[model samples]
Target: MPSITVRNVPDEVHRALKVLAAQHGRSAEAEIRDILENAVKPKGRKKLGSLLAEIGRRAKLTDEDLKTIEQVRDKTPAKPMTFE
Candidate 1:
């Protein structure tokens, strides 16, 4: 297996990784690895409305119900996001 080394890791990023690891019942190292792969991926993110609609489906909402939900969720505010 190949190994990768990352530099310039800020303390806040490290701490966030620790918390994420705990949330997913994984070791910090494993969580950091998962975070690294996901963060570096080239795939485009789902649109906020699409993600919300999927969540609604998982929650067993009917399509007629999800139509209204998507409309409302799409209107929800978008916070300023800066990818580190």
Candidate 2:
């Protein structure tokens, strides 16, 4: 196994990572390894996080807003969109 050293990480970011690592029952290094793996790897066609990020990046909506939109979408009547 190879090793990589990361330096100059801000204390705030490090503290957040420590909290998240504790919450997820993982070591800080393990949490960082996961972050790096997901950050570096592309999913299906594009990177996984980027796809979700872009959906929100394009739409200026919050979780509650998205939930409301989804509820409305689910309640709306669907008409046949095909043109004869």
Candidate 3:
């Protein structure tokens, strides 16, 4: 697990966070973690895979079509980039 240190938070903001955490029945640290998680990765956010799947559904793609695409896809490993 990765850890981060939030430096120099204002006193009022810290107090507010503690109050909010108490209301939510969690510790201040847990509340801060939840706040950060939601801020970065909110509910109802559509990921790329989900979006692509939705598009495929909307286009009415079938299993056979997927198999055909899989069979025809390039299998070669990509060349690594070189900088001069």
Off by over 4 Å in 2: 45-84
Local accuracy by lDDT, each model: 0.86, 0.89, 0.96
Q: What are the models' TM-scores?
A: 0.41, 0.50, 0.66
Which of the two, 1 or 2, has more TM-score?
A: 2
Model 2, backbone clash pairs (residues 3+ apart or across chains), number: 0
lDDT comparison, 2 vs 3, better candidate: 3
Looking at model 3, residue 27 earns an lDDT score of: 100
Candidate 2 local lDDT, 1-84, one digit each (tens): 899998999999999999999999999999999999989887866777989889896887688998887887866578879887
RMSD of 2: 13.3
For model 1, the superposed segments whose C-alpha errors exceed 4 Å read 39-84
- Can you write out model 1's per-residue Cα lDDT over 1-84, one digit (the tens) per residue? 678788999999889889989999999989878977999887986888999878877899887885886787867578999999
Q: What is the model-wide C-alpha lDDT for candidate 1? A: 0.86
Tens-place lDDT digits, model 3, residues 1-84: 999999999999999999999999999999999999989896798899999999999999999999999999999999999998
Instruction: Single out the weakest 10-residue window by summed lDDT for candidate 3.
Output: 37-46
